[model samples]
Target: MRPTDIESLIGVGRPAISSDGAFAVFASSRPDLAADRTVGQLWRVDLAAGTPRRLTRGVHDRSPRLSPDDAVVAFLREDARGRAQIFVVDAGGGEPVQVTDQPGGVTDLAFSPEGGRLAFSARVPEPGRYGTVEGRDAAAEPPRRITGIRWHANGLGYLDRPAQLFVVDVPATDAEPFYPPAPALDEPRARVVAGPATQLTHGDADWSGVAWTADGAELLSVPDEIESRRRDLRDRVVAIAVDGGAQREVLGTTENLSIASVDVAPDGTVFALANDVGEGGVDFVAPGVALFAVEADGPRALTDAETIDLGEVGSHLTFDGDQVLVQDRARGRVRLLRVTRTGAVSEVLGGDLEVNGHAAAAGRVVASVASPESFGELVMVHGREMRALTSFGATARERGVVVPVEREVTGRDGYPVHGWVAVPEGEGPFPVVLQIHGGPYAAYGVHLFDETQVLVDAGYAVLYANPRGSAGYGRAHGRSIRGRMGTLDFADVMDFFDAVVADDPRLDGDRAGVMGGSYGGYLTAWIIAHDHRFAGAIVERGFLDPAAFPGSSDIGSFFGQEYVGTDPARIAAQSPMAVVDRVRTPTLVLHSERDLRCPLDQATRYYAALKSGGVEAEMLIFPGEDHELTRAGRPQHRVQRFDAVLEWWSRHLPVG
Candidate 1:
């Protein structure tokens, strides 16, 4: 796939199964090259027919939810002003009825057990801030009085506004139409007359993961302490009475645990996903979130934390009849796992696939799944078999231009390092480019990632690995480099590259280029400065200096401190800028103008030091973009970045 093929990629979201298990609904998305934006539409499938039917005509409709009786489909669509608003459409077909008009938009839409009420969340801006004052723009508004440490985030600018829970009546649709008997186009569509919505949550905290209890008397949610988490990273599950809006703590994290998602069973059994943060306040290393059953006493672990990495924080967790469905990341593949009442876990779907976004009902389970050969596609599991429901992602793998072959090697302390090597067609000792993933916690999975595809099409072999610090392999592997950033983690990366090249005769180790973003960028710069083996390096949004980060980055307060602590000696030892004078490879510093995660100062400082040290270096900054540029940036910008990367490789590590 070439840079142009990036526009041809297709993706599918999680499926929402009907209570009766007769049908399912999901959102299908594709890049609109002409508009340079992503567009999606809702599609429905009759479980028996197994054929998908278009359900909505909106340009970007998503987050589909099937009403209890399956008469209407409640979904979200961005309004003219780009704020997501709730809309309801007949399940069979028809126009959508607009619901609430929120100031900051809405998200996390949920329908009550009886489908009488709709619950959603939106950030409430301060009295005169965030466009709350009509006719007043953000720039013209009063300056904010800073008080919170977690005030901003990448992709999302200043986050002074707190997200609160809201509930509104989901207007009644035509009595009940189980699946068939479509509604006529001329017939009047269901209308949700705007009524005063009840704000069920208040305070400085953000309320998310909204779910209604079986009796519909109360709502269950996780209240995040946006301000106090920096002082102590912890959260708890709370139950709010729907009538009076009074909240009471259902359960709080014990010792080193942090709450992710929670749900109340019909019998009042509370289930939650809790992350092990070691001690609540600091340790930012990648820790596995496990399933827990909360009772009057305390929370009980339903899944092992040592070996099972239950996906990431806030992963899907729902209670099916006699079992619980959850997403787990094990062996680098994100799969849907089923846990029984006895705490026994087994893979129900996505065994060899990267899966997420799941819904289960009447013994039928549906999830959005992907493989190395495909992007996200809807997959379903019924009775004893799992099958793919869509084939839109087949074009993503193209015929033979790109092939990613799995590679493995033994790294530091004899740890088994895993990765993949994608070689272009008709390659002879192709110039190899080693790509590292961010998160130090995020792993390289089986998805058909567009970046690796674009690189191989440009006639360069790409190697990406899940080194020691990556998640999926377990908590031990993820926490191995907590206070030793430049030690074993770096050794594992180098070992993986060296071993892969030695095993594959087609990979030219000498004409190599190392590149990555975020944590990956930090490691890339650290590698070149320490080893000087690469001919070129591209460090994008790297956390180059740990000392200065504490003051400038959105996550600065605790990011570096969690990595190597606040000790000056330890920080300098882990920072690449401390050894910038030692770099000898030609480097391209890539960053965004508004990346609050690493900030623009990191790249400018690193590049300046490289130039002053008599080394070849260039800086490429994308204006009006954030830390997620390569992934969720403007289509034109993503394409332009690929072009620039190919151009740099042509001038430096050109293919033989």
Candidate 2:
């Protein structure tokens, strides 16, 4: 998918499921609207009727969640000030009641098992650097500084202040800030589940992908961090009980397991997907992906290792205490299957139902399914029957969209570099865009709702190749570029392009564009800085100065010591900024003003250098957005980003 067209189906964060499993809620763009202009709205569906319904009419609403009792839906909406606040709306559709009008925004949210209480994660605004009242509310004064985990931090990327879950009693009458006063330490009140939501773990532990047990007493989650030096995606599954104090890790990183989805069986057995540690570190474990279970004895591999490679990225593993529901996307299409405790896998539904996000409630599973519709439908599945609960599917499927061609390109080092190439619909020569994926750790795969389809539709051939250091290729392939920065990855992109252009004439070798975000951004900038063959380049949220990034970026450890080597001297040599003056190609610098991953400084420095060096360069900055702006920011900003990037290519590599 081109970046612009994928914007409409861009789904991130977590999906919400109704208590009764009748409807699912998700955020998606209106297909009828232009790329640079529409807002994401909450839509619902009648599982049996397969009819989608719009829940919110606002221009920008996101992270829609259903209350425990299913009467109210809580979500975050951007205000005029650009701060996101929590709001509650009746499921039956009406004016939403504002919950938090404060400046500091709310990030993560959840509803207590009982409708009596609402549990959510929020960041209370802190005063400016200089303020008279040290701990004052500052509500009476204009917000001097927007303080919180989601907001952008100056030197230190996005400081994801751990989302401490808070509980506020559902007021008998309408009330603002729906958040109740801090929970009393000594007394156990009915307000919000107290200590359980607080620091359940120690030492800046990141808690995400939270799934509640059927009884809500135990919670299963994946706490993960990428070990850069070792180049490992490490994660542990911990079980936390409401009455228990500290969480216990049942699954460790011994097997190179990065738990993506976990569903606890009625018997307390946790089912997850894991891989075996092979040669190239985590990369060598290609066949390690499989469905597994953990119980009193230990973890056991459930799925047959020979039958499938076990897809993990787009596929989610869920168990109903007995049967497991997995949305497998490894085979190019989304397939739903039921796995019994005996390890017998039966296909439930398999077609073009591209499931992006999913959740299981009681006896049914709710998922975000996209097809030809502009918006994704909240699909519900029960036993042998499947139906769409929401009618928000796209009005008409856009045809002639290019399907990516998946294959392998030989790396300069002789190893086959695996990647996907999307060609535009044309007979003659067409300009090409070398699209790089983020997550020097993440691999480019066949996942749905990707935003890179725009370039191909506009008559530009797109190539997304996973060079050395990308996950899913095996450890050695991923670690091949360690301590080498732009060496191996740079060669891979250039060589892959050579092969593609040699094989296809539609690809105009003379005019080419390079684009990527985060690590991809770094690669894009590095490409233009070191090589001038590209006609134009687009770098989004990528690092320029490796030295400055060590202490400033969120995952400093990712590139600082891991990929670029720990020594400051070595980092400087590998930095794109150190050699930016060499760049002569026209470049478009794009980043969220508040992006934490690469930070705005990375963009500004490169932009200034390009302009000062007499190079054609432009910077697109979205205000008050973090690293996820492209997928989760205000709808307008997302649209503008696509239009701007496309416009840059139009001006430089104009295709008639």
Candidate 3:
């Protein structure tokens, strides 16, 4: 599909299934709604009648969870700063009660089983210790100064606060500035009650997907080991006590499983979709949407499917009182599977099930389906009758256009490098945009356009390839660029470009340009430094100097240790800064000012070096944005980002 076509079919929002299976909620960016932009709102679909009704008029609501009694729907709403806040609206749709007012916002909310409380994740507030906290909050009897001497040690240097979890009363709707009493070393006590927030699995490790036990006394969370020792580290599920006690490793590392989507069965069976790389590499690894029951022994894998990889993002295994609902990624669609304890997964419903949330509730089964072309609908599984319960058009639009064409490029080692040739809908021999993806570990799967589509629509031939060090294919291919970043990865692109031109003479390789964010951005910088194949390039939020990142970025140590080995010297060797002097391409260094991952200094150094060497280069900084530049920036800012990229590419690779 062309970028404009992809934009037009920005399909349904992610559907979420409520606890009771009575309602399903999802978001859509339908042009039929307010603006053509993505507006995430909550919707309730009746599982019995299969009728979906829009609830919560808030424009950008997401991640809806139904209360146990089905009376309330708790969701996240974007505030002024675009930080998501937890909001609660009635099932019938009413004024949303803002539950969380934290600075960073809340995500993945779970209502207490008794329905009297809510547990969610929020960035620990770092209210800076400024002037004496005198008359600020009326919630405090006598407004007092909030101070922390060692807040900086915890990375709260800018703020006079510490990182922690907070629990307020259920409908804590009253906007009151209440600062908890600071912890005194003499009588140190955590402000966030462990029992309330379930501080299981301590450390600064980022935690997500918290699911409460049946009794609500415990919780389940999947946390990625943020240390970053491996390229593709898999997350594991752990059980934590609500009382902030010890955590149990319910899952093991042997599985090499990154639990993508998880659902707890009615009988407490935890079903998860995993990229089982246990049998050596991802190629030999079975791509499984397996059913595992948590036992005293550990997780017992049950699904018998072999090699069929489940779509990690949209795929989930929701347990009905009797069966489980899952989206069949192997089939490029969603399916309703009824799995018995005997390990039989029955296909109850088939075809493309388009809905957003696991947001359907009924007696035994809950269903949701989503499509890139339409708004996801709540599906009802009643005695073999499957139907959509809601109507939501796809949210988010695409301004770029692209046509996917497969091309095989030979790498430096004579290995075939696979890629897709995405040409915007226009005239012949378009100026090429050599777009690289991040992850140096992730893949540019299938044909979905978000940012690059815009570039193609701007009349550019885009080349996206898996040059090695990318996942999905296998470990050998995934690890090929471990120590040879610019070497093999760069060759993969060169080969892919040559093959694309060889296969299609219409591609104008002479006017080719390059751009990428993160690792891809790193490659763009490396490409300009190593070769002059591209006319111009935009290095978005890239890591120019690996040496500087370790001290600043949260996972600095990991990035250096894993990819380049445990030596800082080795990291410097593979980093783009090591060869910045050779760059000749007109490069636009774009970065976020507050990016915690790559940091802005990388861009600053690259820009400074390029200008110092008289290289044609410019730098654009997005304030208040982290690693994500265009994805999370303000709408106007995002548009400007596309404009800047197009302008840069247009200046170099003039389309005619």
Best by lDDT: 1
Tens digits of per-residue lDDT for model 2, 357-392: 667777887666655333365566677677765544
Which ranges in model 3 have alpha carbons more than 4 Å from their true place? 1-13, 18-23, 29-39, 46-52, 78-85, 98-104, 114-116, 123-209, 221-263, 270-293, 300-317, 320-403, 406-416, 567-573
Residues 396-514 of candidate 3: C-alpha lDDT, one tens digit per residue: 33222334666666666779888778776645788888888887766665434556566666677788887777654545666677766777888888788777876776788788888
TM-scores of all candidate predictions against the true structure = 0.94, 0.71, 0.73
Q: Backbone clashes per model, in order?
A: 0, 32, 48
| Candidate 3 least-lDDT 10 residues | 148-157
lDDT of 1 by residue, 327-401 (tens): 888766887889986899988876557886888888888888877777778877897888777877767755333
TM-score of 2: 0.71
Clashes of 3: 48
After superposition, candidate 2 runs with Cα above 4 Å error = 1-41, 55-118, 124-162, 168-317, 326-354, 360-365, 370-375, 379-425, 443-453, 471-480, 485-488, 529-531, 567-574, 578-584, 607-625
Report model 3's TM-score to 2 decimal places: 0.73
**Candidates 2 and 3: which is better by TM-score?**
3
Arrange candidates by lDDT, highest first: which order? 1, 2, 3
**Candidate of highest TM-score:** 1
Q: Order candidates by TM-score, high to low.
A: 1, 3, 2
lDDT of each: 0.82, 0.65, 0.62
Candidate 1 CA-lDDT value = 0.82
